[model samples]
Target: MTQLKTLFFAVTTAALAGCAATPRKYDDESSRALNLARAGGVYDQDLRDSPDGTRSYRKGLFTTLLDVASLATSFDAPLRHLSGTQTFMFNATDIMATPDNPSARPSLIGWMPGSLAANQDDAYEHYVTVVDEAITHAAESMSITATKLTDVKTPEIDEHPLMLWSVTSERYDCGKSNCIIAYNIQQPTYWKTPSYVTGREAASYNIAANHPEEYSRLIFRQSGDERTFPVGEFYSAVSADMPPWIVMYFPPNTVFQDGEPLTYPVLYEQGQQLMFKEPNHE
Candidate 1:
């Protein structure tokens, strides 16, 4: 059921974002794209049957973790040796959306997954632990990290508030010509952590949006870096070849420092919310 919802939102919003691909961008009252960018897995409520260490989750602190495992199972990644640090692993594959457009990227319907033991505490939760480790590994293995980020802030629109952080590190980059992608994954959702944002100002982070950029589509690193379809990497090479309607992840207004970029996690409070109640939201 949850996967179904994700699929609906994914394809629908992707279509909305894709509308801009035509001549003269189309700015409908649609917030579908923004909601789609909320970031999460296709398996969410459907992966309960996944093996010992695999699962799905909504785009949250822990959703990144689920992405690592789910994506690895369905897609291949350039980075290796990340599994050792992960808590679980998926043993399945062959579940991905391989669009037939050179400009599009592969997405997923369902995929295998992996998991790791989680720790429950006030100072930190299992999800935060997962994000921290991915960042650490991305830094060590990818040799990259965002340069400036004290708190979440919009990189594209300075006045948009610090809802997200951006990075310029190699690991975070898409390694493409003009495109780039960056994100960290958290562990699977096992009801072990809070369902929503839980920072000191948790009440401030429930903001949701649908439409994204005029020049770009705000792609969610949903499954984070775990899936075979890397976050900002290629759209699966499968026969379903097409450019991604949604682009990869990045902070709104990223900055470079000493030749590299920095990032901070996003905090979507009510004020940080986007316009999701648009007429085209459905």
Candidate 2:
């Protein structure tokens, strides 16, 4: 009788743990639509169908306990609302950094149930503040100036070649130009790593051969629409005492504008009207 009670308690605890660690899924239809329209239906199918996709998780008792343990440690994770850290290389362009700006800000906390639940007590204003602060800091780190433009809308912006955007998280939007220069990292707050890192190499999936120790893995991709793309090389910040943020790196002279090889090097141009060029270049 005592053994039965112990077994039941253990089972219940494990179940609860799994539930708590699991991230809530939200309607990703908009994201899917964007991807399908830009990247194609086949690539979207690969992500949805593959076992190593971002959504796939290892099931069973061991995985459950591991997830529970991870959740405990993850409570102290910085930027709890965001899955990972990102760095933007905006070149003094007008940055529309709002969540609605799909090109500038690919993903949002409200889009994820698990992310929202973690900060349920906080007001919506708090989320906006945090996001704004993050974007500002990211720009500063690269010695680039990012002026937040509240009046401008994202779609109105023209495609600029110098804009080379990168992220190290689960999802990314390549914007209208159909160029992708991003990588994937395991979510700092979640037990599971993103699928792009774990999934097998296929069309639109090329794992980084020499990813650093700090990151789980990295993948670089050029979207289905063939355009003049930049050659991005990955590097890690060497610091003994760094913050827990998952930092993404992009070097200058790599991103180009149109077919012309850059006579001047710059990155992270904001909108169509706000563009970046070297002082001498026309």
Candidate 3:
């Protein structure tokens, strides 16, 4: 009888261990939406047809634990929001010395360019202050605009679809008779690598040679229609540090008018306007 009891206890312990190792289903709509977005869905239909069903697939016990442990560390720093009307001027010196003051040259080191570094540091400090102020102003404007554009009780998720826009660097310009403006619908942020250095080649390689269905590059000619642009010598990868962007060439003498509204179309949303202004100047 003693041996039989011991055997029963061992089997019970093993069964409990197996049960503990199984992951529970995440059935919440938010989790479902997040998973659908991560899987590279471009439209509501794609999300509705996800094979994972309406709930999160059961992960291994170890994998679920690891995800919970890394939650805080995986959070991304939020982007600095600048005002729609604010323009950042390009200053080589300011760019070189930003986020840190240049180290002072040794008093006896006559060969060092200490004064130039000091000047750069000063300019950088001033530029950062200006940028901070602009961000604050922009936030205020955004709040006011949101109030006017949206019903007070409407949730943001219901008002806006799960979509992201690709913001191009203001400095990009090609000398042409007429410049083209393009907007490419991007995969969900979860599908992208966190570091550009590690994933650049894979992201920027020719779409046809890789996951063509996951990416579709669109070009907008001055004629306001979609067209194909030559994918010149393909780059190995995108710069991880840079935001997703679309390149367009403008016609000669076409300057980005200050105070003019910069508009881009929302993917999947037919008649909604996502408008801002060029925040940088040549």
| Number of the top lDDT candidate | 1
- Cα shift from native, residue 86, model 2 (Å): 28
Model 2 C-alpha lDDT per residue in residues 1-282, reported as the tens digit of each score: 999999997786555434323332322432322222112111111112112222211223223222211322333233233221211222112122222111112111111123323442332233334334544465345333334443322222212112223332222233332222322222222233222211212221111111111111111222332223322211111111112112221111122335222222111211111112212222
Better of 1 and 2 by TM-score: 2
lDDT of 2: 0.25
Q: Which portions of model 3 miss their true places by more than 4 Å?
A: 1-180, 189-209, 216-220, 223-241, 244-282
**lDDT score, candidate 3:** 0.20
| lDDT by residue for model 3 (9-116), tens | 778655543332222233343332222222221111211212322112222322322221122122211111322111111111111121110000000000111232
Residue 223 accuracy (lDDT) in model 3: 14
Candidate 2 C-alpha error for residue 6, in Å: 48
TM-score quality measure for candidate 3: 0.16
Clashes of each: 64, 2, 10
Q: Which has the better TM-score: candidate 1, or candidate 3?
A: 1
Worst 10 residues of 1 by lDDT: 105-114
The model with the greater lDDT, 2 or 3, is: 2
